[model samples]
Target: MANQTSSLRSRGMEMLIAYKNQPSVELRNRLVRLNAGLVRKIAHRVSHQCSEPYEDLEQIGYLGLIRAIERFNPVQGCAFSSFAVPYIRGEMLHFLRDRGTTVKIPRRWQDLQKEAQKCQGEMIRQLGRQPNDHEMAQALCVSVEEWREVKMANKNRMPLSLDATVCHQIDSSITLGDTLPDTYYQRMQLLEEDRQQLQRAMAQLEDKTRSAIEYVFFNGLSRKEVAERIGVSPMTVTRRIQRGIDQMVAFLQPQALQTEP
Candidate 1:
């Protein structure tokens, strides 16, 4: 496997050198094909931070990859992958920024989303139940496809604030920010990975230990209450909780990866 990777990297450099010396459409095409994975890797990473489709991002990324191929300085001794990444990511980001939103949602679609939401709220108040998609479309005098498109556009728009209070009157005092993991672009993927690891670690705990910890941490129960519920003494509950946490921490400890922007 190591030899295969080294051979591929060597071939890639040869292509880059050839392109640098005497650039041609054929050579550029070959180089692009050879380095397509780099663009795809960048596009996938970028997709985490934005609402754009992976396919669209990849298409946009090809333009950058071609640009990188045409302008590469092989004699400079910089790695092509490192040099190409910024171009690919920048192209996708510029494409996103040039449009007002993350995706190119039509203004009419945005307007329709707002109108449908308002109409639905009114109908729910009057009818005491939420309307179906067809009902909403009919009420707005648009086809179901149009209503669906409006909804998809809404989902693709720039994310709203986690600090915004919940829409429910009963829960208006709480912002989603208080309990949910951070969804900031840089931290979102890491936070999601951590959550998955946490779940697995929790699953590995013994049933009673898991129950005790969940009751105290998740259910906000007192240690004494947890002990009573689990038929154990308070000190035993403390020991179980600490041992459970230590085992989980051992399982979930991270091996950090160093990266650059």
Candidate 2:
């Protein structure tokens, strides 16, 4: 079996080399079709925290594969997979980092995040240790379910501003107001409304679309990662996400206009 596989690979290499010299639309299409499984395999391996679907990753990987095939030099005696892996992975990672960083977090959620951290510290100080969810809820004077919902709503909280002072530490003199005014309370209220509206809008999406958005944005998984987890084509994942976003934009536009007054 190993000998037969080696023989087949050798033939494939020869075919690849011949096609490389005479690269054409037909050749590129044929190569892509023949190496479709290879593209998918590379995508599965490279996708880490990316939110783009595996089909998208596969498409990117296929591009790498084409480059590899076109640039393959049998004279170098390098294995095709060895040369292609890094190229494929790099292409996918670049797309994820560039696109994923642009997602905007609501300002209200940012405030809630700061408050939650402060609340957690206060609870710890009073209890003399880190508190469990129940303990934290009790300390905050809220139900466990409400606390969980708050945590979920603020899961995408961004990093704290470096300019902001540390408010409290055992025996520390720093305070939050030493840097910025306490306007986070108002922001948190607005954020809560936005979160509720987003949740309602998400509920209206198709199941797959909703799930894809949740995993990609809420859980911080890449599209390729989500596609692999759900056992679907990455292209399907992309389509669902686009459709979902279009629906959300349409749904939110009227509300936004009403609020303009």
Candidate 3:
């Protein structure tokens, strides 16, 4: 089996060289088919963290793979797999960024955002007021911290443009773009500090709590899905995630003040 697989790959490389020398529709299509598994594998990896369907990501990955195939130089002495993985993943990430607001959000948080929004109107009607995070969580069968995270994710959906106006004072004018820190270096430093602080806070969590956070937030798994993986009820997953987030917030608040300019 190994020998046969190696033979197929060797043939595929030969075909790739031929296609590069004299491109044709049939040749390109055949090359795409020969390496189609690369596209599917990348799509599967991304699908776990994106709301987009697997098929859509697969299509995007295929486009990237084609671009890689076209740009690849067999003479460059790099493995094709190493060269193609980035292009495949990059295409899928770009698609998610452009179409969905999940660029900064974990897929799980986006899914939770949808679930929270679905219950908002009904909860408001029943409560005769805007439901607080706890109330919303109760209605959705999630934890308050998880509900808040969903709210935070929704807020990122339409981030204010730098070109947007910030103030209309009679004697002074301010635009968001103008208020930004003057130097690119400072901006990067601030971003890095925040990232480090978040990492520290996450590190402080217990193993189970951290795992719950990772699977539900970063991996974009639904509560039930996470529960099944960990051999617990969805409610348990919710509680663990909420507690972990709460701990993170507690740690971050003080660190944020210290890090602030």
Candidate with best lDDT: 3
Find the candidate with the highest TM-score and give its number: 3
- Residue 76: error of model 1 in Å? 0.5
Clashing residue pairs for model 2: 50-222, 50-223, 51-222, 51-223, 52-223, 52-224, 55-234
For candidate 3, report its TM-score.
Answer: 0.51
Worst 10 residues of 1 by lDDT: 252-261
TM-score for each of the candidates = 0.43, 0.39, 0.51
Backbone clash numbers for all candidates listed = 0, 7, 1
Root-mean-square deviation of each candidate, in angstroms? Answer: 19.0, 24.5, 23.6
Model 3 residue 171 CA deviation (Å) reads 5.8
Candidates' C-alpha lDDT: 0.85, 0.75, 0.86
- Cα deviation at 84, candidate 1, in Å, is 0.4
lDDT of 1 by residue, 7-103 (tens): 9989999988887787789989988898999899989998877656799999999999988888889899998989998888889999878765546
Residue ranges of candidate 2 with Cα displaced over 4 Å: 102-261
**Native-to-model Cα distance after best TM-score fit, residue 122 in candidate 2, in Å:** 39
> Is 1 or 3 the stronger prediction by TM-score?
3
* lDDT tens per residue, model 3, 70-142: 9988888787889999999998888877886533777677677777778888888888999887787887788
